[model samples]
Target: MFRFFESLIDPYPGAVPETPPRRLLAFLFHYSRPLLPLLLAMTFFAAMVSVVEVMFFAFMGELVDWLAEAKRERFFADHGGRLLGMAALALVAFPLLVLCKSLVTHQSLFGNYPMRVRWLAHRYLLEQSLPFFQDEFAGRVSQKVMQTALAIRETVVKLMDVFVYVVVYFTGALVLVGRSEPWLMAPLLVWLLGYLVLMRVFVPRLKLISMAQADARAHMTGRIVDSYTNIQTLKLFAHTQAEQAYARGAMDGFMETVHRQMRLVTQLTVSLQTLNSLLLVTMAGFAILSWHQSLISLGAIAVAIGLVMRLRMMSDWILWEVAGLFENLGTLQDGINTIAQAQAVSDSPKAQELSVPQGEIRFDKVTFSYEAGPRGMDDGNHAARQANVFDNLSLTLRPGERVGLVGASGAGKSTLVNLLLRFFDIGDGRILIDGQDIATVTQASLRRHIGMVTQDTSLLHRSIRDNIRYGRPEASEEEIIEAARRAHADTFIRQASDPQGRTGYDAHVGERGVKLSGGQRQRIAIARVLLKDAPILVLDEATSALDSEVEAAIQEQFYALMEGKTVIAIAHRLSTIAMLDRLVVMDQGRIIESGTHQELLELGGTYAGLWQRQSGGFLGLEAAADAAPIGAAEGQTRGEGEASVPDRQRQ
Candidate 1:
């Protein structure tokens, strides 16, 4: 019993696999089995209560008939003691049944089941690959998870409620009353057939509209969160009205779908009410006629009327229950559609933990396209023609070599690094670390061997101390402070203060380190990497945010940190890479020039031309394309900068 509740805590408790069509049933039953015994108890006791309800009407009829003075005194004398005992037993049982139902219901519905389902579903979602998240909104995904769990609880509860009552009450009513006037039961039979037909026609339509409304609601939520997350951008663009209009468009879609659903509900209610009214009137009229004809007792007429009224009330309640069930069904279908997807890339069944002895990296005859065009289009035919990010590019980094990759935007520099990190599996050829194929190793183990610092440094919304410790969770405080000092982050960290009354390592950096400056975030990132101290290091525009003076000061520490580590540095600033062992310049994803900075300049090749145009030893996107020809500006010194690309050339 304890294990059953424990099972709920881990949403992904190694569920058996199911086919797509059976997924909904499998999802429901997976979490419901634990409560099977309770559900059965609830169903049995609850059904007996309906039987008691039917008896109550019969009791009322019997009491009324006995008071009429026709065989009244003798009937009481013969059966009064037994009758009183039965009434006392019923009075005790009614509240007992209701109490049992309430206690079981509270545990099953309002206890931990819904939240457990939610936790499990969300945990399953967390296992989906990066691309899956990239394709949808975080807010929408979270919303779907919540809806799916609630739907599970509501769907089960209502199914049991409606099914139990409809079967037990209807069957009991038919058996008890039909024995006397069997012909009068025809209206109820007709009502049953009509109700079935109505549900069959209207339920699907209700489900469709409900699904649309859920989607619209999710989309609206995503849009509003998108705006909140980028509030600064909206403020900078001065587009408050534009944002409102965008949000209004989503709201309109949501409102339209909801209105359509409500209209269907109203129509169904009126139609069901009319059918119920006809059933009530027909049963009452037939009972009066039967009594007048001397075919049944006066008590039977009252009993018939009471049963008809009870059936009317039950039918009305059941209709709304079915409607609520349908609404939740639509939500469940939507949730399953989003949450259930085949994982794009996962660790191979036989993949092993990576053991990096010496991280000598190599790209062996590699070729890859992003599987979509630059514009993110994926027309089936066009995918085959997608332009390659890298083609037949081969490179080797000897252990502990510090080599720099210099390239313009879109030249596949990041793609190469991304592939090495196994963020995306390669299309062809192999990326090897220590001669071990990356694809054959678990991603967690593979990534642990490499440390990276990119241009856009994002930090968690946590204290500076925690963020730095994130790199190496078990690192001693002394080591953490040492890393910060090496990365030159300790001084500003100690002096910095914000409106939140926090300073230094204890201060909270807002989401993506929004509370800190560009340089501050970069230094924290650098400290993190320093704390990590992986065998392989990648610096993609690592010092781009630092001014020249700071860059010069930090370069000494960076070089010291890079010693004896296999380093792959990418920088647009010429001076940053000028002192590296070799400069491998690329254009269009192919190596154009390679050698030391002086050696390449002496060669008077593309690198030489580019060297002359660099400003403050840095190359910007516009300048890289419009660099003067070799020796064109020999008299002019560096830092004058190249002009922007010609419009025709850019086109």
Candidate 2:
């Protein structure tokens, strides 16, 4: 029972496979079971309405026979008041029955029932892991959810309506016609066989067409969303014409698919119409022959004709309804595929919560590679290349140790930080915090203890105060203001204004904080980190976006903020980490050197060369003269720096 419920919740378990059409119907039934009572009620009403329609037609046949017999007498009297009353009753009862059926159908199918199902499905989708979003486009996912819900609702309601009516009406009409003159039903049976064959032949094609149309629509929507998201990039690169052409091409493909499906539907309708006309003519000829041979009365002929008409109409209606059901089923099937295919990140079944600790971090033989290489790429070809971001690398940081990491671009700086935060699991080794393996801890609880500020600052479209408070949702207004002051953002928040001259921390930041300047956004991000006040802090070129003047002003406050915290700073600019007690210089994902700024300079290796290149020109002639290498002094004279210099100088 438990396993069945689990399967119901996750219909496509294990890597999502292609679900057969029947599986989609099963999923709908499982989810919509809660509304079964309403569904059954609607079905009952629909059956009753159909029966009433057949009875009304039968009554019309009776009325025609009565009029034929009473040529000179009062028509109502000749038939007696009972017949008149029945006709009158049908006039009132049919409408009442239809009204009741419509009421139930609308409430159950269009109102709360489907909406509740959609709400639950949407909630479950939102609970999916980040990898799901990584693998799918946001707009496409949303479109699938919405369109699937609507398709399911529409298809279910239509299937219910058609199923009930066709069964009840066709069964009743067939019985009546067979009793009146059994030969009349022969044609209908043949028609039913032909109809089944037609569906078998064409339904698969319709399903394929529907699936193709859905894919085209999703592709067009994804393209539009991508273009809008990168509108700035498009304009900057002067690719407007190219983007427009791409969008038009996608739209054209979508329209072509839609038109092809429409053509198929048209062909189906024409074929069905011709078949229906032939059946009508054949049945009429049979009725005429039977009447001429005196095998059936005129009244019986009337009844048979009425029954044949009902059967023909019901057959066409049912066929069309079934076609629509299949098309919608195709759409629903695609949506199910999307949701099922969403890649879920591996998670432990019994993950433990992260306990508060003293923030000691250790990386033991950690190695990571973002991509698996091609089969033929040799080890030496790879080995001489830069190592995997972290190849058999190890590090340890005690509680409250402020360490700085210096490395060139592509030297595993950000990768190290990402590992510490457990964004991605280490490939070969364990990352432990206070001796607890990170993989054992709950991801949410583990991240709550760490705070970060990156070079690219991002803020939500919300009030400045709210953005700051996002770091710690329960923080009081006073606490937020204090954090802002520490990050030097309070002054800017006070000066910030929206239109109409309103100014304060309550001012709204535009989407992704685009309304704010880079410096202002950085300060706000820093304020968020301060507000979080986590035990471990990671600054990955955090202040690099700010100008030198702003950086200098914030560094003093940053030092004060760093007290009693475990800090890891990664920077390319050596000057940023010059004041740290210890500096670790990395090359090709391996730490090649570690020491204080002065100690590294004295070693006169990679660090010394980097320092010389940065400070050599800025210090001017006298400073350069004092620092000239032993053999280069005769060639490089002081105060002759500019006069004797060539057009190009290499550092």
Indicate which candidate wins on lDDT: 1
* Residue 472, candidate 2: C-alpha displacement in angstroms: 2.4
Off-target runs (Cα >4 Å) in candidate 1 are 1-23, 26-100, 109-111, 372-385, 476-481, 491-507, 626-651
Report, for every candidate in turn, its global Cα lDDT versus the true structure: 0.77, 0.72
Best by TM-score: 1
Q: Give candidate 2 misplaced runs (Cα > 4 Å).
A: 1-26, 66-104, 111-131, 159-161, 294-317, 371-389, 462-465, 490-508, 615-651
TM-scores, all models, native as reference:
0.85, 0.79
Candidate 2 TM-score to native: 0.79
- lDDT string for model 2 (428-520, tens) is 788888888887887777888888998878798888999999899999999999999988889889988876465788888876787798888
List model 1 lDDT by residue over 8-56, tens digit each.
3333446633212337777678767766776676677778788788777
Clashes of 1: 2
With candidate 1 superimposed using the best TM-score fit, by how many Å does residue 219's alpha carbon deviate from the native?
A: 0.7
